[model samples]
Target: MKKALALVIAVLMVLSIVACASPASSNTASNSDSGTPANNAPAAATSSDSENITLHFTWWGGDARNAATYEAINAYMAKHPNITIIGEPVSWDSYYEKMLTQLSGGTAADIIQADYKWASDIVLQGMPFLNMKDGPIDYSAWAEMPAEYAGNKDYVMGLATGINVKALWYNKEFFEKFNLTPSDDWSWKTILEAGEAVNKADPNSHLLWANSDNLNAFMQSYILQLTGKHMIDTENYKITCSVEELTEYFNYVKALFDTGTLPPIEDLVVYEGLAYASQVPEWLNGQWGMCMTYASNTLQVLNDSTFEIGTMLYPVMEGATDTGISMMPTQLLCVNKASPYQKEALDFVEWFLKDEEAITISGLQRGIPANTEAAKLLEQNGVTNAIINESIAVAAKHAGSAEGPFDTNAELNAAALDYIYQVAYGVLTPEKAASQTIDAMNAILATLK
Candidate 1:
């Protein structure tokens, strides 16, 4: 009887174990079913079709400027649902260093906006350089550029972003006060004399403009005017000039500094680039008569100024070697070989070069639209911003003869500009400065090649 009881208990225990195992097996099956959807996966992302794509974009600008860019990019995203752009912006002070690191680290943006000064280095560093003819890069559409800028069948590093034409920015209030007229016929000689007259008339005020650094942009303009040459030429890989020409340029700068027409070096050091950016609050508020800058940027300083401003080309040097002004590529756009979405980037850039949307969004910050149709669109929009329109007009008139393929290594360009400043400050003689520049530039060029 006891053995029969034990056998019945064992059978009951086995039944209980079976019940537990059933539930556990069912739970495992349910979990596997839950993961089936994940294993099936979703579609890959791409530029076209239903695929999604993301592009990294970067630029340098102020807060207001960055906000405007954000708005533009947001609008672009709304139009193109599949494409997302990530913004990586920095202040101008940190822009170059940051970009260099990004590129060198092999994580550059898909489409980079480049300055002509840095294009050669970017290309030489093995970033899948593009020619104008790549896929849809339409250099022909860019009106501000010369026909020659068309991407060579070889390695074209960048596309024209905009044409930068330098011009004289005068305070309307001071011009009227001094009875000086803004004219195309005004020459460098006229500017010097007028500066002296304006300063003499108002001993407390400065008649001429000043920048913060030793390299005088003012000096470059006059030197270019006198010599019909540029300090750096990337196309032929030449630095054109003799020590004599540089010495004369430096002497001219010294005269301006000594004359009481322009600000002293010390004062200028405290007020660098304020003439363009109005960054120095005190100097901006102080009495300054005229400033020199690109036509596209003249309005930036005056937009909030209490005084009226006027724009015209810098005075041509009388009997100057070159009849035209020194113009440079203010900005450029290039496709990154490292970009995963090269085709999409090219298409977007093509649109930017040719589309109306790009013109409206850019607001011609870098310069006038290089595209012919884009320029017309800007005009049709009744934007009628004089600075941009004037820049466009100047570019249309004389971009071809503007000396440069200014593609010297960015470091060389910086070095050359630095030397120019040193000479202006009387820190070095023109001969020493010129020799140093040539040697440094040659070293840079050799490495680039």
Candidate 2:
């Protein structure tokens, strides 16, 4: 695959050249509408005004993640004394819907651990968030900001703290029982063959682990592996795959569903990995063999299994001209463009990204740290978060240390996911499904453009 170096360099120049504005200029009277006072509302009438900086921060994750993040926030507050960081955590299911209301109503939090899928839509649409480039925030620290973002001044919304690498995480015991080795050199065809072997070994067990909800991202990884192109192109507001290619991908997935090698779509939807791990289900009970997922969720999958769970890059295609490349881009922290605490927010973000205290709390649960110094601290502490370590290593090797594909708006992702469900459930043939998806997506992309 050709390097996107020229694209990357051009983005960096644009971010560096945007105009700077005052914190007051950025904040509007609408701040009060979000249930928070403006940044300069006379510093409060209280005598302890020095200890009154309240920053509301929001993120989406499971309970373990919430606890770790709150601990980090508490530690920061304990030292700062003068600052109070409000923690607003939500589950992934409802997070984006609630946040879209907040962003639209001008009630967005001071700091948002943003999804990359939503960054382009939110920032470029002027959804009332602070532009990092228009302030003193340093783009130099973020190595993963894609060329499109780096080069565009108006869309500079957030700083990425971590990145995720897609891979096939499997149980060692299952492979041992089948007398099979999880081959690093295996292609997608080989993976299907392995799945067939596992299916034959236990008719009740599935060889591949998945829910109906995740088929699109799985397809994205698979498509990128085959074409070296993104599912959605931010620049053109388009999907690049031909109709035939998309039909082939969806048909393959549908075949897996129909063959009993993967769970039925209806049964899988209620069994998200975060909610189902540790129950010793067919997968953890040593029934299912391999699962497609990210490093961040490996702990959830392996938390209860007695078998040694290992992670490997997404299986490539045999004799293919291109290597399988996992999509890489974890969420990031973005300031409300209307935020009054622009400088202070930047200061807090800078510390959060670069501070040792923050790194100790994060431990790459959300993603691999983008901060070099903070990553080094995690390394030196000799923590055994092997999944994170492995994810970082794989991302560096195959993902080129650049920002991954992004959606114009976060909602469009839901639409894309819906298309996956429609196709998977046999509501439409792969050809018709792909055509419907492209048509639906192109309509949404038009709104973004």
What lDDT would each prediction earn against the true structure? Answer: 0.61, 0.65
Candidate 2 residue-wise lDDT, 115-159, digit = tens: 666655564554445555544555565555454432244555567
The candidate 1 region of ten consecutive residues with least summed lDDT is 36-45
Please provide TM-scores, in order, for all candidate models, with all chains considered together: 0.77, 0.79
Per-residue lDDT tens digits for candidate 1, residues 127-155, read 34344443345466555443323232355
Query: Global lDDT for candidate 1?
Result: 0.61
Off by over 4 Å in 1: 1-48, 127-129, 147-154, 212-223, 229-239, 273-277, 324-329, 356-367, 391-400, 406-409, 413-449
Instruction: State, as a TM-score between 0 and 1, how close model 2 is to the true structure.
Output: 0.79
Candidate 2, which ten residues in sequence have the lowest lDDT sum?
A: 38-47
In terms of lDDT, which candidate is strongest?
A: 2
Off by over 4 Å in 2: 1-51, 139-154, 231-238, 272-280, 304-306, 319-327, 400-419
Task: For candidate 1, report its TM-score.
Answer: 0.77
Alpha-carbon RMSD of each model: 12.5, 13.9
